[model samples]
Target: MAAPLTDAGEFESWLNDRLDSLEVDREVYGVYILGILQEEESDEEKEDALQGILSAFLDEDTMEDVCKQIIKQWTECCSRSAAKRDAEDAEVQAIASMIEKQAQIVVKQKEVSEESKKRKEALLAQYANVTDEEDEAEEEEQTSGNNFTGNDKSLFKNTNVEEVLNRQKQKRDQAREDAQKKKEMDKMQREKDKLAKQDRKEKEKKRTQKGERKR
Candidate 1:
């Protein structure tokens, strides 16, 4: 068996800070101790033994239930000693005080939770604004700048608007301007060749006429 609780102070300390999983067992243990005090145990001895047998457990409401049962049994079965009454009274007061402190702690925890929630909401709102700005920038780049969406790339089979425009420029130069320039250069070279042929024919005709006169 586990060692018994040795002090009245130990009960209240456990009630304030110990795990709640054992609460039912502790309350049931309190009931068992009450049942055993029906015999002629000294009030002092009973209180001390009760402490050693049961750790402090239960909330204020449940504690009041256990205290009522213990007080009633002590009065009826044991001697109605003043010291025992005083001691039980002090124990009841201490339990009440611990309950009040727990209530205050709960209120403080709620306030802190609300503060954390507010901060989280503020952070989310700020992040949403930043995300909106980035989305706008991307949309503008898609419409006007040299960028392409995945759908745009697949649909057009091109990277960006700039590439499309540059390809169109090259097509225009090849189809109209470059062809016209080649035609003009050909016409000039043909005219120059014709003029040289005409000059040579005229000079040959003049030389033939002079030779005939000399003969």
Candidate 2:
């Protein structure tokens, strides 16, 4: 008598404990629990208990189908969440790379501007020096006394003026040439800088692509 009572109480208590630990699929467990509780207190009760236990624990054919469905849905949800997180991380990384590229461009542009300013200052200084030299030469010619024959006087005057004009023209031409050379050199340097920057950008792009491939 005690052994039969113990067996009945054991099944009932086990069912109650497992039902309390439920998270989902509550309807299935509810139907089984009710079926067990309503069974007669005889061999019928034992048979019902066995049937309910088989339904709850022996999940080989019918319950295996439900578990497969639950696992499939759970796997899909986890995969979708992981993919969304990965996409967001990639977007943030792209934005950060763009910001770095723009910063490099700005730095290169500032360096070019500074170089141009320095070149202009150098040209202005050279022009000022040439102008001062010309003024000094003109003053010396005007201070020289007139002591010569008529033809000699006329030749000296015309030659002196021509020499001064020619010297001034030569100075102007030299200044122009120097400024032009500086501008051309600066242009070439800027082009080289641009090329180097482009190379760096290409390398960074390759690195980013490699990282994505690894992922």
Model 1, 27-96: lDDT tens per residue? 4564465344544255555555555554455555655555444545445433434456668999999999
Question: Pairing residues by index, what is the TM-score of model 1?
Answer: 0.31
Worst 10 residues of 1 by lDDT: 1-10
Candidate 1, residue 38: lDDT: 43
Model 2: per-residue lDDT, tens digit, 1-215?
A: 21111222334444455444543243566455434343434444535454545465555575445334333333344466567677889999999999999999999999999999999999999999999998877765654445345577788889999999999999999999999999999999999999999999999999999999999
Residue-pair clash count for candidate 1 = 1
Give the TM-score of each candidate: 0.31, 0.39
The lDDT, on a scale of 0 to 1, for candidate 1 is 0.63
Candidate 2 weakest ten by summed lDDT: 1-10
**Local distance difference test, each candidate:** 0.63, 0.63
- The top-ranked prediction according to TM-score is 2
Alpha carbon deviation, residue 58, candidate 2 (Å): 7.9
